[model samples]
Every structure is written in structure tokens, then in C-alpha cells.
Target: MITWMQRHKKWLVITIWISTIAFVGAGFVGWGSYDYGKSSGAVAVVGDRKISVEEYQREYSSLYGQYARAYGNQFNQEMAKKIGLPEAAVNLAIQKNLILSYADDLGLTVTDEDIAKELVKMPAFIKDGKFDKELYIRVLTQNGTTAVAYEKSLKRDLLLQKVESLFDINPSSNEVNNLSKLLFAQDDLSIQILDPKSIKIDYDDTILRDYWNINKIKYMSTNSYELAISKLPFVTVSPTEDELKEHYSKFKTDYKKEDGKIKSFEEAKDDMIKVLSIKATKKDALKKYLALKKDEMKFDATTVIFEDKLPFSAENINEIKTATVGDVLKPFEGTDGFSIVKLIKKIDPKPLAFAMAKDMVKADYLDIKRSEKINNIAKEAMKDFKGEHLGFVSRTSIDKIKGLNPNEAYGFLNKLFMSKEKEGRIDLGEKVVLYKINSSKLGTDTTTQEKSVKDILLRLQKEELMTSLIKNLENRYEVTSSLDNKE
Candidate 1:
């Protein structure tokens, strides 16, 4: 099955970075301030606009709390700090502000009715088939949301979604079909792999001594110290009761509602009417487009015999049979969207006979047989290996294991680590050659205390490398933070 990311690669890449920051607490930070009248302190200031400190703290707390719930005991303050949770929250705030600003600039507006309709779709706010005001209030209150504030946020979100949809243009059918084929095409290759163990490595004690001496600095021990760290207090102004009341009053219009059972006709009547209208319009549009296409092709559908029932109207079936090049069918509602399908060509579906499918089955069988053969070859190659030192090593430490292929090191790490000390070779099926471990250590030496220092340095180096790579990629992309730009 194709993943959501695979289906929407461009959008996935754009949105995933922001999502990652919200979840993993790692990414960009921007200078910005949020202002909500008299109760505001600079959370961050992008340009002239201020993001309130309270708002920043609220967003951070919610995000981090969610991460803790998902990760459970693994979530710790140290991990949060390491992943730059504060920075992530700031970046998310900037992104949100930017998107909202863009929507405002474009004069995009979402009506109160639009928000209400969207709210009905939220499972938490719904009971049976109707929107449940009590459940809605309860959930929002539990999440520290005031009715007015939550609605404003929801409105902003809806506006952003509208703007995003405006940019959601569909590719031409030819383009979509070409892309689909590229994505779904399968390749069959007859591959032969040579086991690395088949290559001999000459090991001499003198050579080991010489190599160890020249690279002794790389294996040195250093003094180590363990220390405990604690967080220091940072000052922040607290909101008074009067201030909270004032803030609530200013935004209260967003939350005003009447109590009692809502008649669907009264609450969602407009929404239902709009939906029905759109459906009717689409049906009419399709019928008109199909009639035009049928006239162009001058073809009759009476000759074509469909073995199975088609999920289309009689007019739609005629349209498909008569569709010619360059004619566009009206959009028909599908699971994802209103699909405007162009009949490229109608190829008759035929059931594969036994003889027709025989070659395909034979090919699949041979592929499996080849994989098994590769595994057997690897086992036979390592039958006589013996060494004083053995055991599992990290994939990155392939150099430490003699007569091993660095390229295939990752495949063997788990097997080598899990292997019990034995005389014979360990066989990993399907071209993966395994190594036997005679002895093992945690890559640590208690006697010298030097191994710990070396390990720490190595870990730090790898982390630094990863950080640099991420920075380079981020720099290459034009990452604009609304938190910094919004006035």
C-alpha cells in the first residue's frame, strides 16, 4: 500500500518539518512577540506584531504534554531540552502566524456557519449524529480553552485550510497517469551477490601491533567525571484575576451560544443546503459534458458488453464509450475529491488463462529460489572461520571485524549481536552473510576508564555531523518565519 507521504510527496515535505518540531521538539526558532491587549508580554516579536508570552507558553505546554503522552516514561525534561522544545514551539507559532497572515492578505474569509459546520465534523464535539455542546465545552475546558479563544483559533485554522485548498490544483489526467505508472512500476532483476567473507584478509600479529601503535591516539583513555544538573528559575509575570476577566470579555463574542437541543435544520440548515446544491450542480455539469463528448465521438454504447455493473449513470456509460481525445468529463464525486476523469482509452478487461499467467508464476518462484540459493552460498563460504575475538558490533564498527563487507555491515549487526558463541558460521537468509562471535564486550573498559571518553566523543561527533546536515538542508530551502515577518 502507498503511504500518505508517498501519495503527496510535495505537501508531505513542506508540512512534515513543522509537524516534526511540534512532536520531536526540534527545528527553527524565530524572534517574535504576541500581543493580546493589556495582558501581553513579548513571547516573541516578528516585526511589529507581538506574540504573547502566555500564548507561547500555552502552545509549548500543550505540545510537550502531547509528546509525553505518546512517549510515556521515555519523555523527560532532559530529552525536551536536548530536542530544543522551546525553539520548536516558537517556530510553530511563527508558521501559524505566517499562514494566517497570508490568508488575511488574500481576503480569504470563513463564515461563522463554516466554522460551525467544521466543528460538527470533530468527533470530540459530536454525539450520535449531532454536535454536542456539552461535550464540546467539556473537552475544550479540559484542554484549557475558553470558548471564545477556541473559536478564534478554529476560525483561523479554517481560513488557512481554505487558502491551502485554493492552491490544491489537480494535475492533468495524462500527468497523473504518467506519475502513477512511474510510482507503481515493478522491476525484476537477476542479481548475483558475492559474499565478502570469500575475500581473504591476512592477519599478522606484527601488523596488528604496528597498526595499533600508529593509531593509539584514536584508542586512548581519558579522565571522566559525572555531574548532576538542575534547572534554574526564570522570571515571568503572572496574570491577575482582573486581567483574565478583561481578556475573556474582549474575546467573549467568539464563545456566545444559546443552551438547549439544536434543531439540525436551524444549526446546520445552510450547510446541508449548500452540500445538496453542490451535488446537484456536479450531476448536471457531468451530464452536459458527457452529452458533448458523445456527439464528438459519434459512437454507440450498444455494442460494448460490460461483464460487471459499472457505478455510473446510463448517460455516463455512453459518455465513456464515446469519449474522444481532448474532451474533459465533468467532475464526479469520489472518496477524495470531485474527479474529472478523461477516458484515455477503454481496454477490455480479460481474465488471465492458465497459460498466460504461467510465466509470471514461474518468475516469482525463481526469484524466491534465487534468494534461498544466495543464503546457502553465504553459509558454505564461512564454514571454517575461527577467531579468538567474536561477538556483535555496531554496523558503524565494521572495520573492527576482519573479513567483513562494510556495505553489508548493517544487515549483520542484529544477527552478530544476537549470535551465541559457537564453532560454526551463523547463516542469515537471502544473501546476508553472518559472523560468529567468540567473545564480546560493551566496547567499554572499566580498568582504564578511557573507553568511556572515546565512546562519548564518538557519539558527540555523530550528533554534530547530523546537526550540520540538517542545518545545511534548512539553509538550502527558503524558510520564512511569519513570527519574524508579521507586523
Candidate 2:
């Protein structure tokens, strides 16, 4: 059986790459503006919970300093600036606070034992193949982190992990199998060549104006605010030349040392050899598979499928049913990856086999259990709940809620708003979320209403633009980076 990591190796690689880039660029800085001393420094405010400049700066500096030390000369001030380090750092701090706030609200607590257990798992604290308390203290001291602070951080991380786990949606065995089949299934013979030159758009001013008007919401101006806000005075903490020298001497080794522990050649040689062998084996296997596929091409017909119809033919079905080793069918176009299937083995699709789908089934069951648990928690919380009615809250209104998707919350809100006074509960696809509508009101001010609409429109446009850019880049570039194989 493939390990979860192995099964999702490609996704893992992509995730790692993205994470590495983000880590390097933003250095784990959460969402917010970096200009903390400025009036616009505050990224967000949850009620009266204000994230201040000093707090953001301290966190950012600490995180950035750690990153610089970890990456040594590879991490420079210029690079940090380019990545919007100040803003990223502030955001990170804000997000941490927000998560902790939510965790507190949910009554989530971490024990000392949990912190200790998590600390032991950290590779930095390990020495000579075991947890080393002295080494841990020494390292933390070098990094200017106290044991108490580290423990707090560990506890927070653990709590956040738990909170995130609460939101985990495990795909069912049927879902997983269906997804796998869609990913690996072969396709019938087909060719599609789109010619840009063949396509034409009329260069009419009337048409352009019509299109612009239809999407004026897309390209409209926002009501920009003018402010006479005052900034907090900068608190300077300068070190003397002697102090700087002392500081450098004390922590210079920490920065000079490699990010990870260095293993002896003998220790890593076997693993390195194994990795190389696997690569060679995969290369040879792919070559053989491709050759066999070319030789075994038995289809002599072509068929076209529309956007709304199935792409498979009778021959394609038969080929898939009888698929064996080295038998390659036509390339099947998918939403993401193209599939050129070469069946390793064939199994009769029968009643769900326990051995084959046990993990998937377990995941599904766990997801269901988690959802039920959250629902029960929410239900208990709302037992005597009397809340003001949200007339028509959009997805953004419930962004503060944990264990809930914005879209899901939007749908729930819509249902709640539409339902009669007595029908307080609404089904949110997977589980029921109960909401009480306490009051309803319509806006009178056109400017404020227009501003709200414009804000939403701007946010939507930015999201769409970013998504399109990312999609285009992913489609064009062939990114091949494996964390497991990284040197």
C-alpha cells in the first residue's frame, strides 16, 4: 500500500515548493500592512482588539532574523524588502492573534504535556538521536527565545493545528476511487488544434461600449477615502558599537550554522543511493511503458465529444476494461492533468473491498465524525442563544467564524434570511447550522451602499486576476521539484 505522502507526492512537491517560496519570501508573516507606525498600519480590527505597530515589528523582526540566520547569506535585506517583509510580518502576527482569539472563544486549551510532547518532536532540540534538554535551552537562548515563550508558541501551534483539523473534510472511499479513476483512466483517439488566427472579434465601438457597460462593475472606480490620521511616534532602540560587537560574537555561530543538522557521508550514503536507484528504475519503466504503448496501438477510429457530452467510445470502454501492463490508450484531456493510461493491473469493480478502501473509508468516517462533533458543539452553544438577525449577510460577514467556509456561510445566511421566523435551522449540505434572525434593515444612503458594492467588486476582481495569473503560469510552466529528493 502506498503511504499518503507517496500517493500525493506530486501535490506534496507542489505544496512544498509553494511553501518554500512563501517561507523565503514572506517568512511566515501573516496578513497585514507592514507600515506599523503609520495610521494605515492596522491590517484588521476584530472589535476593539487592535494589532499595534510595536507588536508587529517585534514579531516581524524576530521571524525575519530567524529566517536570515536559517538561510545564512542566502537571505538578504533586499530580498526581504522585495517580499514585503514588514507587511508579511504584521499579517503573520495578526493572524496568530486571530487564530488564538478564535481558539480561546472555542475553549480550546493545550496542556504542558502537549507542549513537551511537541517540543520533543522538534528536530532542533534533538541531539545524539534523542531529545536534549540542555541543547534545546542553549539553542533557544542563542535565538533569544525563552523556554516559556517557546512553550507558548508550541501550545498555540498545537491548538491551531487542532482547530484546522476540525475543518478537515476527508473524501469518501467512493470519492477517492472516483477521483483516482478520473485521474488515471485512458482516453479514445482525438486531436484538437485551436487556431488563434481563425478566431475574430469585431472592432466596433458600440460593441466595446456594450461590453464595458455590461462589465462596468468590473472596471469601475472605488470611493477612495481621504484621511487626516496621525501616526504613532517611532520608538528607537539603538545599540552601541560595543554592544553590536558583543551581540555579533555571541550569536554569529547561530547564523553561520546550517539550517538542518549535517549527517555523516556514511549515514546518508545508503539513502542517497536508494533515491538514485528509484529514479533510474522509474526512468527505465517509463521508457519501456512508452515503447510498449506505441507498439500496442490497436485503435483505428476517431470520435469527437462536445463540451456537454462524454468523450468515450465503445472501443475506448473495451480497451479500458481489458487494459493490461504496457497497454497505452489515447491521451485523455482533463481539467488539470492529461492522462495517458497504462494499466499496471486490472481488478473487477465489485462491492467495496475493505482492504482496498479501508483508509479512505476511515477518512470519510473521521470527517463525518468531526462534522457531527462541530455541529453538536454549535448546537449546545446556541441552546439558549438569542441573537440579532442579519438581514442579508454576505460571505464576508462570517469570515471571523472558525470551521466554516465563506460560501457555506453565505448559503446558510441566505437560507436563514429566506426562512420563516420559526424555521431557525438550515441544512448546509454536510451539516445543519442554526442561525437566529433578530432584525432586518435596508440601507438608505446610496454612497455607503455603493461603497460596499464597490469593495466587494474590487475584491472579486483582484481574486479573479490573481487566480488567472496563477493558473496561466501553472499551465505554461513545468515545475518539477521534490522535497524528498532535495539536496
Candidate 3:
């Protein structure tokens, strides 16, 4: 069910991408002097198309909101800015306009009936297995879009599809057969999974200290917050069954299996309760924050340093840092629950002395030495194996190797397929695999081969065509941007 929904969502996104053109009318809105070429009120202009600021905001907001919801507590303005969401929004706006201009030049048109039919077909606008106009309006309004705007956008999407379809390229059956033979060909190999546990390494105190001195900054203490935190633990809350069910209904996307089916309530009840409880804690924490803001309540202050080492995230620590001494910060949610912090002090990160960081440095040194020892073992084994004649192993036949763990075997096969030298070693955590492919034999799976090649060819041709079209459109159109100017 989840996969079905995901596939549908992907199709919906693709449809939306195909239809609309973004026009940027980046001229001033009557700001300063000198009349900087009439404020067209567009963020950008491509040929005759003008992309308005409102359209850019709508697109950016839609994308931003989706990510914000997906990320939940982790999504913040800082993170959005760091990811260059604003710049991406502007760029996407420009790209949209470029394509729309090209589509217009090609004389592509999407009629009212086309948009109406598409709207009725959308599951989102449907109720009782039928198109509901009121429901459609309500859904669009709820999502900060109007029916007119959505339809107009949908029209552009249809036009894009029309334009893209003209360049469809189909590969011949023989070409597909040849490619399939190459891709599906199996290789035989001699394999061994090296055990890291079997190989031991010894490091003296002097060696550890020397390594620590060189990499001391990597071992520096986290920038922590010394604070009085009142944590509202979610485990204290007991949610009603109705509340759990409601929560499940609202956030069902989170509980979907890879195969797309949603877990039954009975299977998901415990997890649902946990999520609801955390939300409840956050709500309570907000109430506490408000009360503290108004001086109506005072939380018990037990001072502790909040750091990454103490199970709290860097995001939580950063939130704590945002507060000043005696300022009760607005509560923020963490992995455990919600925390309200009164910042007492900010602890700057400090490099630990050799004596202070001995155990940690020793552990680090040992890990490095162990990896080196294992790599050396694999290398030495490779030399010995190269001289001895070993039987070939098929790409799909790694499971036949005696005593190889399923995960290790798959990891070995992945390396085997990807290796450029036809022989290489793969470090699979606890084990290492040294494989050498001796020969390849193509399997007789014509149907599968044909389908794979067809899919690959179609995707490649579309990408190449679209790229060329976009580049040609950009050169053909007289494009200008108002996004670079101020006021």
C-alpha cells in the first residue's frame, strides 16, 4: 500500500513538472530612482513569459513545507538556509519559465477539458470513489492553493508532457539483447571473508599518545551547554486508544513497510503511543514555556551540562546555546522528549590532555591498527591467491561459497560487480572479502534483458533530449532576472 502511494506521489510530481511554466518578472515595484526598467513585478522574464514573485513563493513554500513536514523536529530555518532552499527556489522558478517559453514556441496547448479530466482523476480530489468539487476546493485551499492556480499549473504540466513526448527514442530489439547480455553476465571467483576479530593489534601508551597529539582536535570535547533543564519525559503519559488511532491516521506514511503496506493498528499501536506521547510532552512543554514566559510558573532547576555525549543531539545543544543566562528558553523536542532549559553557562570545546583522553585515544589507536592489520592480511592473501588457479563464481552464485554470511556474500557480490580491475577486496565490517573474477558467461534471460535495456534507453534519451531542449530554449529566449536586485 505504501509503495502504491509512493508510486502515485511520484507520478503526481512528474505530472506537475510536465505542466507548468514559471515566469519571473524581476523588475522593481516602484522603489528607488532612475526608473530601473519599469517594475514588471516579476522575479524573472523569459521571452514573453513573466515569473511573478507570488508564483516563486508558492512553489518554494510548497517544496519547503513538504520537507519541513518530512523532517518533523529536525527541520528549521537554519537548516533550510544551509541547504540553500531560497536559492533553489529562485533557480527552480527560472527553470520553469525557461521550459514554459520553449513549450509556447512549440505551440503546445492544454485545454480546459484536459485539466478538468486530470483533476477528476486525482485521488486527492476524490470522495466516495468519485470526483467531489467541494472536496477538491477544500483540499486545494487547505494546501494554500486555489483551484484556478492549480488548474493553470496543471495546464502547463500537460504542455510539458506534450513537448517531451515528441522526442521519444526507442532502441532496437537486437541492441537491447546485446546490452542485456553484458549487464546480466555472471562472473566466477575465488572468495574469502577475512575476520577482523581474528586479527589482533597491540599499541603502546607512547604510540597512542603520539597518535592523539596528531589528531587531538578530532577528540576535542563537544561544545556543551551548562543548564538547568526540566525534561517532560513522554514515557509518563498514557494515551487513549482513540488518540493513538487518530495519530496513526494522521501520520500513517511514517509506518509504511518497504513493500508499501501500512502496519495494522495492533502491529503499530506501541509505536503510535510513543509518537503521541512525545507530541503530548511537547505540548505540555510549550504550556510550560508560556507559563515561564509570563512568570506564572517556575521549574525546578537541577544544573547539568547538555552535550552530544549525553544522548541529546547537536540541534538540542544549539537550541540551549541560543538562550542567555536566566532566560528560560522555549521548549524544544529531542529524541527522548521535550526539554525546557535555563542557560547557566556555555561550555567551550577544549582539547583534552593525554592523561585525560588516554582511554579514548587508546581505543581509537587500536581501531586504526586493527583496520591496517586486516587490510594487510587481505593484501597478502590476494598475492597468494593470484598465483593459484581458482574456479570462477557467477555474479548470482556467491551464496555457494562455503561459510559466507548472507550479508557478507551480498557485499562481496556488490564489490565483484563494481570492481574495475576484475579483482579486489571489500571490507565488510567484521569480515573482508578478496574476490577475483576468472571468467564471465552471459545468461539466457532475453525477456528481462529486453525490458532492462528498453527502460535504460528510454530514460537516457529523455534526459538527453530534455537537456538539449532546455539549453536551446535558454539561448533562443531573451531571459532577464529581477532576483539579483534589491528594493
Candidate No. with top lDDT: 3
Summarize candidate 3's per-residue lDDT along 1-487 as a digit string, tens digits. Answer: 3344334433222222343432211110111212224444777777898876666665555545555456565665555555655556666767777877877877788888887877778777678999999987775554445677767666766776777678767888888888777666777566666776677677688888889889999777777666766777665568788877887778764663322245677888877777767777788889888887677877667655537654455566666666677778777777667777777777888997888889898777777777888877777887867533346554555557665777667776666777787677776776766777778778576585578678987777777777776778778888887656743
lDDT of each: 0.46, 0.45, 0.66
Query: Could you say which candidate leads in TM-score?
Result: 3
Which regions of candidate 1 fall more than 4 Å away from where they truly are?
1-39, 47-49, 54-72, 186-188, 195-205, 226-487
The lDDT, on a scale of 0 to 1, for candidate 1 is: 0.46
User: Lowest-scoring 10 consecutive residues by lDDT in candidate 1?
Assistant: 224-233
Model 2: worst 10 consecutive residues (lDDT sum) = 14-23
Going through the candidates in the order shown, the clash numbers are 16, 11, 25
lDDT of 2 by residue, 375-465 (tens): 5655665677644333444333555333457776567555544555642456666655555544444333234344445444444454454
Off by over 4 Å in 3: 1-93, 120-145, 202-217, 227-345, 353-359, 386-411, 427-431, 471-487
* RMSD (Å) of each candidate, 1 decimal: 28.9, 27.6, 9.8
User: What CA RMSD would candidate 3 show?
Assistant: 9.8
